[model samples]
Target: MKKQDVSKCALLLSLFLAASSSQLVHAEEPVSDTASNLATNVAEKLPSADMNSESSDINVTTNQLDATLAPKAEAITTETSEKASSEASQSDTMAQTPVEGQSLNLRILSTTDLHTNLVNYDYYQDMPSQKLGLAKTAVLIDEARKENSNVVLVDNGDILQGTPVIMAGKYGDHLGLIDLEITFQNGKWSVNKDKSHAQIRKIDTKSELADASIVEIAKEAHDGTVAYVRKQVGTTSAPITSYFALVKDDPSIQIVNNAQRWYAAKELAGTAEANLPLLSAAVPFKAGTRNDPSAYTDIPVGPIAIKNVADLYLYDNVTAILKVNGADLKEWLEMAAGQFNTINPSNKEAQNLVNTEFRTYNFDVIDGVTYEFDVTQANKYDKDGNLVNPNSSRVRNLKYMGKEVTADQEFIVVTNNYRASGNFPGVKNATVNRLLKLENRQAIIDYIVSEKTINPSADNNWYFADTINGLDLRFLSADKAKDLIANSKDIAYVGPSATAGFSDFTFTYMKPDQMTSMTSTGMSQADRQAIHQLAAKVYKETRSSGQMQASLPKTGQKQSTGLAILGMTLVGLVALFKKPRKQN
Candidate 1:
């Protein structure tokens, strides 16, 4: 053939042979980028002129090229497919490796509400407790760290006296052996007058302790002293005072009641009510030392200590300010009034003044408003703030500064975060104007520190309605309450109660004006009519069973008297105030 044709044929044959020879020798595979570059160079080198002149020779050479490289191409394609499958399998293995977990194990060590119990010792009981103290927890923490290289330790606040008094109250009351009534004098708990009722005592509330998930710890710690149960989740502080004393009907002994009100009045009286001061109120539970109000008693009208502050404000609830209308404010008090069971005027048998099911912590008394709860009528809301008796009107004579509160009139109320967060009926729709950084308990402490001396005297802003003229109500309180009960017309101290460390007291219904407030107990025309009808109905129903079976929402009943009072209609009130309840 011609020289150019022979050169073209030689070049094509050499390229094909080189490719085939590489595959035959099992040389390193050419990467995709390198193979693409080689093909581009080979195409550039082939001239169009040479291809035209050497068509016949190129056809003969192409046949030989295809025959020789066909096997190599097949082998290369097979090997490529196998390599791609292997790579795909490796990628899948990597993707699934995370699901099998890691080599290192992580451990978390945590404790909370230590309450300054650093040593394995009980300061109040004067005893050693192996179950409490950070020192005891340290050993376990070290063990945890040693077992796992990846470990974290965390403490969840409530240091010092920031611990809640309600916890101590529940523990003491449920155990029924801890002396919550022990007074503070000379920087120590006052010695029990009755030697048998000592501060340090054994507790056997097995069911309660177990339900609390601290039975084992309590058993180990309770050595003739208050339980010093310590665990990772929750811990208890030393009980310094009575938790239930704050909610006592006898405002005289209610140190916490006046303290909370006084704190709000002094610190949280917002600028909105500057012309006419705002009221501070909270719904604190009566956990212990519930008593009768017969005689008046003061906190010696002297300087208060920091320790006493813990008794006044029991929880860690932060302060919150709510701008509410008079109507909703009255409704708030009505929800609080649910703490008391309806008192049947006609019932002769002894009836409980306070609803045991209704937690006393919900009974809110506005410091600036004078209100009376007519127990003769049904409660408007349940303990959870559900409107059970849509037509029932229990809140009566609700007035601010001797004037009847109007629906349109706005007022500021000082309360805690828990109360302000739409937890109760009247307060659910109230606008939270501001939330303060100070906790309720811390505020009380600060107030005492600022004042140095405080007189926690109740203004008797709230009381029961005088409509039940002569119903003798019976309530239980700590035995020490007997000393404070003066022989008054309204209250009479009964003998020791069957319950250990408790006493019974008889309280007769009387006018609020007779006791504290000079403001007349005037009733609206609607309240008078409702009261008359209720009295008549109770008289008829209670005569047979000596009990007025009023369908109160708190009692889980669906029926109610639906009595209308105070001209405050309940139309659309439910929809206006309904909100999702939160767990405390």
Candidate 2:
């Protein structure tokens, strides 16, 4: 063979080896992703598309599945088969299979404790390839579900109290969820009022110690000592006020209610000149003690547990069923018992520092479970690398790892993802089961791009006492709503879950997550008519029997209030100003 021919043969062999080597790895063709880079290039030139929009084409789609199913315009499906990888290692396993009897399997993609990772959670790279966002993540979920028969998208929790996304939402421009945390408690060492009441007490919630969680209380002077549970994740410097959940005092209401008693960090820290804004409902030990609201050494604000945002369960826009996978049910009871055990009976002799209402101050029960969270210890890291316990051991609030023990029976627990990953240490890998990861994570964008129109709606049923502006705003946690869905077993309602997140708010009439812009109480003329019709249908079914509510989707609500309020306000103002004033 000629020398040149030999060289060519060697070159071809070298190319073959390189191709084979690719099978062992997913070569990060860092330069290949042109959309985001191009987008960045265009961003400075133009404006950013809606943050929720997966595709630049924010148009409508006739078939919801189309947009949800389509991959990126440039995504090569045939190439994917060629790209099927053995990315799974001993540490993690990845699998994909078509469900039996269906061309597509129902895909459920979940991400918990995102904590405001609107951008890639890793802050190293300030670009798309390095970030994980609901928008980018939405693409993955959309594609996976679109490729399968049915798909469910879920967010585990802590969605509102972390990162700039949440922080921006909370303080408007001043703060976000990522900026919230408890700095100090002023009265952590306040002395007990009397000997009979004791310095501390531990109580049981009617459950086994091993099978239960506990609640503890530290006694202090007066009837209105405040107990506060601050937002664990937010601005670091932000001070958390103590709170009390109020419903236990109201005997007339038999139903569940979450109220609060607010205490400033200064009071908990045993300091005067208290700079913390003590916006709470804690009456002074003596009713007339707090005469000033602003600079008064003492005042009252919230008990944090108050349903002031709305009526009990109404904050979710509807009543949601909660499912807790408790092992013995007595475990929580034991935690309470531990608190009752801390009572120092001798404190009863104090002349001025007697707290007469100590027994009355307890956890606001949901169903039968009661929990009193430790605000101070929550921020401190313990030797075991867990949140330090601020409260006495008798009453423990936070659960890290196996401490609080979840039943894992597959139901909602009314908590955000931060607590799910044992408080966000890395929950995605905590308990892996049958998880359906998205194929491209951008399939929804492709589907939406494939079609032109979009209908964002869900079938979660949320019956309530009434609606505001003709719609209800009360809501339940996603966990509770899910219970009403799978186990509610109402033959009337089909596969829909029961939820409270989407009452009077305007929903897209499609999936809650799919909506680009929904009002707080998604009830537009378009949505109102739709929700009204749905509410009417579900209401009728609920009245008929338990089975009726079972058929509805438990997650019909979307908490995204971005455009819902604006849309309603604009429409209302237009209607108000557009009216021709009557000529007298």
Candidate 3:
């Protein structure tokens, strides 16, 4: 063999050895740039003279090169296949590993119309009650927080006025006085009068002492009258006054001349400027000097709290979750719109805005939907939330997330138990998914404590649509809401309303162009007329209850002719029965 051929053979052997080592070790690092450059240089250096040499020498060199490289190439192929399979397995394992970040547990809590039952006590019955109060709800809130890491709480207004303590705080000395006059006689205080022998007392219907017995009255004068006065004036702050006078006087009995000042001092006891000493000495009941305290035990005082209106308003409502279809949601919106009266476009002078019976708390303001109330049409529900007119479509163009709401679409509404129990319109058949056992106030407090902070602004997800003829429709709200209305984007302040304590604001209603296209196919004029008549009949039946008479005279007219005849007959009888007087 030639020296050059031998050198080529040695070089090929070294290349084969290197390739074998690389495959055996399964090297993952790529070949260095320097090594790659050296390989390229060696390939270029292969002599051109050798290529033109004898074909036999070229064939022998190629055969020897192929024999050495063939095994290394096969080993490399097997190792690459194994490596690829292992890498794919590792990728699969990595995919199964959980991604690391914060896990979210969001919760929303709401309380509405909590009428001040802070301690679960009924002042009227003068006993402890379990049915209502925020204290009972606090336990549920604590439990909720333990289960949920993230929480948001909100209150739905109407909180400031409910209990007797609240009323007393709001109205101070204006709670007027009770006057009782007694004369000390025969070692006791007795009713003093030159007229009738019966006990004389002047009591007003509003007077807190109207139910007080003679024994209670005598006891009231002996002491500073604090306990009696507090007992008499329970939850209401109505202006009431009473007078009692005594006729006889006795040296053994003590008479309080300035009873008003004495009672005032006692009633003011526990306050900053209370005269405790004077209050203590005001009422000093002696055994015989005053009437027996036990005698008045049977005479029960009228209920201290007025039913529903005053402090008697209880906080028994609970939070609930309602699942309903789009149709039900639309019906509810229509019922809420019933808070307004129907407007006649032809009669612009008619003030057909908010209904007189509409209550602010009863009118629910929902978020996350856009809708408009058509005032030209009658409400589907009456003021009592009864289905008065099924054909009436007051709720128009209801859209969720800018798309028209479909009848088949489902929605969830967070509402009070009263509303969920079918007390309110539109949810009579709704499915109740959940009921939060916590009281609303406590829930709100817990949510705030857990969240640390909250966003107070409304989402503005809904608004009234503009009227068809561009006529502005107005509604009444608190006069103080003028600032809010002026700043509002959807409503404009129109000035004070005819009703006191309320100001009127005009809201945008749906324009004719913006209204949803309602189609009724295969309906002839006769069918439409029949439907109209049916709707009218339903409205009259549900709303009026047949008590309304079409031919009844105006309320201002004379009620009956028989009463006039009876009055004339009585006057003639008196004249005919007149006694003739003789000269004395």
The alpha-carbon deviation from the true structure for residue 46 of candidate 3, after best TM-score superposition, in angstroms, is 99
lDDT of 3: 0.34
Alpha-carbon RMSD of each model: 33.3, 30.1, 42.9
TM-score of each: 0.48, 0.19, 0.35
Candidate ordering by TM-score (highest first): 1, 3, 2
lDDT of 2: 0.21
What tens digits encode model 2's per-residue C-alpha lDDT throughout 3-98? 222222222212222221111111101111211122112223421211221111111111111111111111112112112222111111112221
Candidate 1, 87-165: lDDT as tens digits: 4333222222111111212222234433434445543334555434544444444444554433222233112123211
Model 1, which residues run further than 4 Å from truth? Answer: 1-276, 284-286, 289-303, 517-584
Stretches > 4 Å off in candidate 2: 1-253, 257-309, 317-328, 331-345, 348-364, 368-584
Ranking by lDDT: 1, 3, 2
**Candidate 3 wrong stretches, greater than 4 Å:** 1-316, 483-500, 504-584
